[model samples]
Target: MKVTTTLIAAALACGASFAEAQAVQYAGGKTTFDGKCVVCHQAGGKGMDGLAPPLVEYPGKYAGTDEGRRHLGHTVLYGMFGPIKVKDKSYNFKMPSFASMSDAEIAEVLNYVVFDLNAQHGSAKPFDAEQIKALRASPVDGSAVHAQRESVVKSLGL
Candidate 1:
């Protein structure tokens, strides 16, 4: 009985620790976004008027789909270039890759963008490091990533 009780206590403690870690990570993600992505995406994720496309809407909506989720990971990992339209506006800019960041950091930043900034509570499951890892395993360039985006947008009929 004592052994069982000890095991239960240990499990609970571990659970609590995990929760706390996640909270910290979420905050860190926001910080990372502010420090790294804000230059072009802006404070509230509103990209430059015509220079950089706003990251406000599409990111969350993209997270809602399977391919879109992959796209998000790929975009961050490989970077994106060329012209793309968002909110009925055209943006022809190059988004440099952030492949240097760890998978966890990438996941956290996207989570911040999808949940905090966009408030996309109804979006698909939050991205995990494993997903980022898988995408990173098969590398692609920014232009190809942009081409994939076209397909994703078309499939969503957006």
Candidate 2:
């Protein structure tokens, strides 16, 4: 009984530590997001009315699949434009490209969106710099990214 109790306690402690470490990873992402993403996405990523789509829902869904994950990276690297719908709401704004940002920075920002804003802990996977870098090589325009998003959304079975 004592051994079992000790094991449980250790597991809890480890979990707490892992959570703390995970939070640390978001710090850089949060800073980058605040400086660049906050004006459109708002403080909590609730998004603006008739303007930007909320980051809270789709990002978690996007993190679930390989294509979805690739779409996330392409969105940042290429910047999506034209009309797009989120949660039955139509938004037709042009999101500018952030291709100048390094791979690590982009990954961190996406990590912020996927994990912190979306509250997708344990349900979605975190992004790494390598993933974004891989998408960087094959450059495409914002229109392509938007098209990719369309296909990815459908592929998600939504």
Candidate 3:
């Protein structure tokens, strides 16, 4: 009876730890977004008109593809500037680099954006910290990042 009770208690503790981890993932993501991105993207990632483009669509779609996933890592690590079209709208703005953030933070925030905010990501796996870490070896300014974005968008047909 004592052995059975101990096993049950261990199982319960593991379940609680799993739940807490899940909660922390989203909560950290939300905190990161709110503190860093919400000012430009606004609540729910709606974005500002003629300012920052809405993140609700393309980012989720980007998460779905391999190159697109890399693009997300590049954009965040390097930042982006210049004019880009999203849907039927155009945005010519400079997005500052978030290179200061840790790899895990980048992954978590992107997972929040791609999974929680945008519903179109489909079966895309959550952004992993290694991906962000790999991109960190080469650093580029926001303008170069924007130029690369043009290529990425064209290739992806976004």
Q: What TM-score, computed on C-alpha atoms, does each candidate reach?
A: 0.81, 0.81, 0.80
So what's the TM-score on candidate 3? 0.80
Determine the C-alpha RMSD for candidate 2 after optimal superposition of all C-alphas.
Answer: 7.8
Q: What are the runs in model 1 whose C-alpha is more than 4 Å off?
A: 1-25
Which residue pairs overlap in candidate 3's backbone?
Answer: none
lDDT of each: 0.87, 0.86, 0.85
On residues 1-158, what C-alpha lDDT tens digit does candidate 2 reach at each position?
Answer: 99999999999999998996577558899889999988997886888877888898888889888888888898888889888888789888778899999999999999989888876644577899888888988899999889989998898766
- What TM-score does structure 1 among the candidates reach? 0.81
Residue 54 of candidate 2: its Cα lDDT? 84
Query: Could you give the C-alpha RMSD of every candidate to the true structure, in order shown?
Result: 10.3, 7.8, 8.3
Q: Which stretches of candidate 3 lie over 4 Å from their true place?
A: 1-25
lDDT of 3 at 140: 70
Count: clashes, candidate 1? 0
Residue pairs in collision within model 2: none
